[model samples]
Target: MTPAARLSAAIEVLADLEVRRRPVNDALRDWGQTHRFAGSKDRAALASIVYDALRRRASSIFLLGADSPRAVVLGMLRLGRGLEADDIARLFSGERFAPDALTDDERARLEAPIPDMPAASAGDFPEWLTESLERTFGDDLIAEMQALADRAPVDIRANTLKTTREALVSALAHLSPEPTSHAEAGLRFHAGDDGRGPALQVEPEFIQGLYEIQDEGSQLAALLSLAAPGEQVVDLCAGAGGKTLALAAQMDNRGQIFATDIDARRLAAIHERLSRSGVRNVQVRVPRGRFDPVRNPQVADPLADIAGTVDLVLVDAPCTGVGTWRRNPDAKWRLRPGALVERLADQATVLDRAAALVKPGGRIAYVTCSLLPEENDDAVSGFLERHADFESVAPSNVVEAAGLPHLAEFATPGGGLLLSPRRTDTDGFYVAILRNRAA
Candidate 1:
């Protein structure tokens, strides 16, 4: 397919997303199934255009003075791809399968100088998040949000149980991998100009479980827990067990990790991952029934016996996932106000469960892949108010315990650490460690 045709396809996908309010992947998949003639390259190109448009959706709308799929795609050509007017005009020539010829108004708008935009529009994020983001980033809100609007690099953590970081990096040399700035076991790969990263999953090293595709921020969050060898740990929300596998490597397969999630379906992939990575210390605990602490506390739960005895509990709670916008640009637009409120409630419940599981002097690492203060600082504050036995651990101390003193710079005012695209060159993640003070 020609570039113009690919752009036309992207516009259709975006329109589908706007009307159906479905995930970008779902919309793209349905489009591909219907247009079976589109080659792999064509589908990938269409996906890139659609994602880029979403990433710059607000800015594109501002530039073109319209929110239609065609206008947004055209504006992305100028704002995202940095195409000249002539270059865009060539693509929108009204030829067969190409977008209709650009109207005089569109041409004029494209050629006009950019106007001053509000932070929400300039940052390409929803207007509702402006105040929350401002509170979190203050002076650096636009820069931080702009960084999120950009593409993310692919990151993988070397499975220390099977290979060293240096060995893994050498094996993947063809991909031009680099050691991550903060995570000692992480390697980073830049995406191509087409916005696609190396197919690491197909690499022999990846197949052999030499590395796991994890964000640098996620690797650091797992490290912050400091799950030492021979310590009993509970991965309270160990969905897919990414962090659970990391914790297994940290413990050298010596201590037991009770890895479980409320939804058994989410934990299905973990067994295969654990086997591939040679992780033996993790015990997979699938919930047998609904997990409502108030109604059915620890009912049919595997970790019931270990209550008030765990050395560490990692609560990787669900949230708006704002930090992952660089990779999931569509989610930033799909997010709604009600979703944030639901996440806050879920976070509180998980934190309370973690408090019950932790032994005296044991740590509870509260983690969220969210930039919202409501899910980060506010949630932690609320947790502490409810659980008097738990005290907030200083970010400096948490990083020091993890042997990552450099991360002290990203410490939040509320004693947690915040990692962002602009600050840490990583996805947005908030981690706070609270210790049980009761004897």
Candidate 2:
């Protein structure tokens, strides 16, 4: 399909999403099913336009002075793709399969000087999050959130259990992979102009489990846990076992890792991943029966026997996923105030469970793929308040223990490392280490 035609299709898809409030992937898939004639390239191009529009949704609306899907796509062409006014005019020529001709108002708006916008509009994020983000980032809020509004590079971690980083990098040389700045095992691959990366899943090295597609920040989070060999660990929220596999590798297949999640469905893919990565130290513990800690406090848990004996407990707690906006821009717009409250509650519950599993002198690594202070610093503060026996590990000490002294600069006021796209060239992640002081 022509570029104009693709833009037209993207506008339709965005309109559907705005009305139905469904996921972008779902809406795109439905559009594809209906438009069977659209080729793979055409579909991919359409999706790219739609995603770019979403990535700069707030800014696009502010620039165009309208919120319609057509205005969004048109605004994205100028803002995201950096197209000139005449270039956009050619595409919106009202030809068949092309968008309607640009109105006189659109022409004037597109050619006008960009007006100063508020932080939320400038950064293309939810307006409700401005206060929290301002507190987290202070003066650099726009730069930080704008970085998140851009596309994300595809990152893959060399599975140390199967091969070394050097070896994996050589095997995937065709993809032009580069080593990540912070993560020793990470390799980064730039996405194409269409906002898609190489299909690493089908690569021979990937099929052989030489690497796993993990964000650099996520790899750093797992590494910071410092899950040493022969140390008993509990991956409290081991969804899909991404970090669980990383921990098993760090343990060199010596110590045991009790990997489990509240939702069995989330754990389903873990077994296959563990088998592929050649991880032997992880024990998959699926919930046996109905077990809601709040509803039935006495219900048996998978890790009940190992309570108060674990050397480390990794709480990769769930949050609003604001950090992943570079990859999931639609989520930022879809996020509501109620969702943050629910996540805060979930983080508290999981941290409490992780505290129960940590032995004396053991460590609990509290992690969130969120930039919100409510989920990061505030959550850790609340945990420290509830468990006086557990003290927040100093930023210097935590980074030293992880052998990543360079990260000490990203230390938060509440005592955690904050990694972000602008600051760390990675997805936003917050990690804090707490040590059990009571013997």
Candidate 1, residue 320: lDDT: 94
Residue 310 shift from truth in candidate 2, angstroms: 0.5
- Model 1 alpha-carbon drift over 4 Å, by segment: 294-299
Q: Write the per-residue lDDT of candidate 2 for residues 39-83, one digit (tens) a residue.
A: 988888888899999998998899899999998888888888888
Model 1 per-residue lDDT tens digits across residues 1-439: 9999999999999999999998999999999999999998888888999999999999999999899999889888998899888899999999999999989999998888878889998999999999999999998899899999999999999999999999987888889999999999999999887788999999998888888999999999999988999999999999899999999998999989999987788898999999999999989888887665765676676778899999999999989999999999999999999999988888988898888899999989999999999999999989999999889998988899899998999988787999999989999999999999998
lDDT by candidate, in order shown? 0.92, 0.91
Per-model TM-score versus the true fold: 0.98, 0.98
Name the runs in model 2 displaced over 4 angstroms. 295-299
Cα TM-score of candidate 1: 0.98
Q: What CA RMSD would you report for each candidate?
A: 1.2, 1.0
Candidate 2 lDDT trough over 10 residues, lowest sum: 289-298
